[model samples]
Target chain A: MSGVADDTAVVVDQVSKKFRLFHERNQTLKSAVMRRRRIVADDFWAVRNVSFEVPQGETFGLIGRNGSSKSTLLKTLARIYVPDEGRVVMNGRVSSMLEVGSGFHPELSGRENIFLNGSILGLTRKQVTARFDEIVDFSGVETFIDQPVKNYSSGMYVRLGVAVAVHTDPDILIVDEILSVGDGAFIEKSRKKFLEFTGQGRTIILVSHSLPQVREMCHQVAWLDGGRLRAVGPTDEVVAAYGASIEAESS
Target chain B: MAASYARELIATRELLLNLTMREVKGQYRRTALGQLWSIINPLATMLVYTLVFAFIFRAEPPPGDPSGLDLYPLWLMCGLLPWMYVTRVITGGVASITNNAGLITKVYFPRMHLPLSVALSTGITFGVELGVLTIALWIFGGFPLPWLPLVVQAMGVLAMFATGIAMLLAILNVHFRDTQHFVSILLPMWMFLTPIIYPISLVEDAAARAGEWILQVYQLNPMLHIVEVFRALLYDNRLPGAVESLAAIGSASVVFAVGYLVFSRHERRLAELL
Candidate 1:
């Protein structure tokens, strides 16, 4: 709570998160009791002493290979996983789209899901109600809005989900691999929305494997390698270093 | 910190209300009877109990009744409706956290609201069941109109109790999947321990044979006091003593406090665990 700065949107002060890699998941009562002994070797640090600052109005990119803790860092920033060490401070309200359609109930209609998803993203019901038509229009699923989302095509599902999510009006948005949603046209539309959103002085942390998109959209970039911060700076420099590393590894 | 917690809860009141609405709506969706099944479920169970206990076994209602209705079906319902609510809340709540793994892993909110909203949604069904019970009573000339206020108080206390237990079980089920199966097994045993179909007076003979502490320990079950209060108000049309109602409320508060503490302690880790 102490790190309050006007220009900083988010601060991760040496944050670390650890996970227990149980050889046998001790979820069952018999195993939990039988193997009460703890093993230090199984403890894995997913985010290790990673410190960075995302200034207000910046679109930050987190880039790494699959097991490099990029998503875990974003999850920590979302407060989905509390940091084991240090702290994360945010200057404004934070919302995350870690996965598209994260909270959509298949049984619920698109209209119900709008309210439900909006509330999940921390928007009040009145806010969702005010933007209901806009959301439905943006998703372009107004024709089938009353039908259950389970019946919608996968493209329609992600379209509605992303539409509701982006409209949450968050000061800082954390998105992980959400750009890979929907068909070509919808992805283009979503990219446009992301640019417009960042233009309004909101901060975004984008986590994706698409290097070209990251290079295009991110003003600042942080590269993580094996749960540690490898390099962080302007997008071009870090992306060059990240690209060179991938080339070196592949060679 | 507790003040801030309460303030945070108040600030997120809309999420709680919407989530509860979602629970209530999603549960009965696509069902033939819709939400009427909420009322009919308990009503049918009450009739089944009435047939087996009242007619076949000839179980008597508690002897001392000012309103003098004392019918067995009415007696069974006085306790059964609240019992159903409690069980629903616990069973539903234990699954609430695990069931919404997608939401918990992706978004952040006050996690306690999940179980609390589940309990509240079940309370909606409890309300419908109580209304059906009242109408049924009127049809049978045993409507406890004068005791409506007391029934309201009983519902509040019962909800508090159920929410507390639900919160505790929900968190526990997250850490230990066995807690889910454990609770499912524990519920039927819990019902028999409480005097839903029979009166506490029936246990008097057992207390005499065993010891006085038998009944005292039985009364220690919070559900017993809740059932007793409901039975007194709904079946006998009499007000329970001040001490009795206060004891039920106090015990409920204690469970709720403990449950809240445990839930808050583990709530943050739930995202990682789930």
Candidate 2:
């Protein structure tokens, strides 16, 4: 593994992720054999030769319209998708809250899911146990912690999931517009937690459609268009360039 | 590569343990009989086999050689329980990657842990079933308590073998969804091919009449030796034949190695594929 500078938090070097666009899924023996091959699809590069770097303690935003593949790039950084080209090097431990409840088992209780979700985010049982009370209290679902998450309201469920995810204590946090979870007060509380995250000099890689959120929270921003990096700079400049492009297109 | 994979596997031990616990708990969350179903399922199948092979067909195989006990259901269970565990692990493992697509696509961990944890959870259920069967063997004066250690060892080897096959097919199933369905239809054929319902003596007899090559081809089936190992330890209260146990370990290691190599080759693409 190549080492990055201590001042650099993340380096995305010429990363590209290819996806298969299947015409007809060849998911049966009959189809596979009759076709005389595994299913073949058109090669589509979702993230194309995108390169950027994040300095330590910088809250970076990936801003793009729908279908720009910013989310794919984030997934690549999170190790969910191995880049077909180039590499991503991170200097610190990373955790991604990609979705509100990515790893929750509906049949398990809220308490059990806290441990399970925490484990999925790379926290050990002992680490999760250490913050068990804080996670539960943050979620405000202590009344129903023992009940299966299937029975909890969607809001309650998302709160518990978010609670477990944010508490994993990663040096670099990845998010996909899941920060504003639950009702008004919980959202405010979680926002404060994220503020504290940046105050602690942690880096965050955020992919969001909300330009205001990006401008408000991000120090640096990378604008993506059609799976390519359009512009990258301080938050205001990139956000303005992205906004003008959207306006030009809508007109 | 293998060293790093093994090291990461060790580092993620807690995740593996929790995944196994989730599998075991999720399996019986709302069931009426709960964990007893693991035992009852085998017993029911044993009763059916005992009736069909021992009663209706009037097949009277030789008793356990040294233990000197002869009961149709108990003898049938000695092999049947292990076979059932094989079926459960394979079926569960082949779908481990595809079934957990939500988790796989969203979060990242060591992907191999999915199938391994499934195999381990199946091993837990198999352990319970084997414990009950061993106790029942004792009740019938089979005296397998002395061989309990060997039973655990046999289970571990069989689980490895099953997990290997599972991991290999799981990648296939992701590419060709029909693999699961195809394996389901083939399982009964596999069970019949093994010596669970009938003794290996019958196979030997057929081989004698047909050709020596017949038995040689039959022995190529690893499950036949696996079943024999269990029957030797739990049913006969003796060590498995030297060659038979060696074959079991050899095939298990080969399969596990192949499975790991193939799975690692394809594991990264699984998120995109799924």
Tell me, by TM-score, which candidate is best: 2
Error of 2 at B223 (Å): 0.7
Give stretches of model 2 more than 4 Å off: A1-3, A38-40
Candidate 2 CAPRI grade: high
Residue-level lDDT tens digits of model 2 in A1-251? 36778888999999888888977754667876777775677999899989998988889999998899988999999998999999999888999989977778889998888888888889999999999999999999999999999999999988988898889889999998886557888878887888899888888999877787789889999998888999988999989988998899999
Model 2 chain A lowest lDDT segment of ten? A24-33
Writing each residue's lDDT as its tens digit, candidate 2 over B201-250 gives 88899999999999999989999999989999998999999999999999
Worst ten in a row by lDDT for model 2 chain B:
B57-66
Q: Largest lDDT belongs to which candidate?
A: 2
Q: Which ranges in model 1 have alpha carbons more than 4 Å from their true place?
A: A1-4, A36-41
Q: lDDT for every model?
A: 0.87, 0.89
